[model samples]
Target: MDSPWMKRSRRALELRDGFPRLMAVLNKRKNFQTIPSEVSSST
Candidate 1:
């Protein structure tokens, strides 16, 4: 797994910038799924 810091940095850059660069950064997690925080709290 990639470091949390690295992911945060890449996400920040993507949000700050735009277009092709953001697309490249975002593409890294194209297949990822986010478990909802509500579900975690319920568990």
Candidate 2:
């Protein structure tokens, strides 16, 4: 069985590893949204 401290540490590690991936996905979505709008406005 895992200790509570171990569980908390593991959870923290998971969040740390996942944070960049989450940021990258959010950035990609933002770019996807802006690119089309910019193109439409220019043309």
Per-candidate total of colliding backbone pairs = 0, 0
How would you encode candidate 1's per-residue C-alpha lDDT over 1-43 as one tens digit per residue? 9899998888677656665764564465454753445423632
Among all windows of 10 consecutive residues in model 1, the one with the lowest summed lDDT is 34-43
Task: Provide C-alpha RMSD values for all models, in order.
Answer: 10.4, 12.1
Give one digit per residue, the lDDT tens place, for model 2 in 5-42: 99889978886887798567668878877444532453
- Clashing pairs for model 2 are none
Clashing residue pairs in candidate 1 are none
TM-score of every prediction relative to native: 0.38, 0.52
Error of 2 at 20 (Å): 0.6
Off by over 4 Å in 2: 27-43
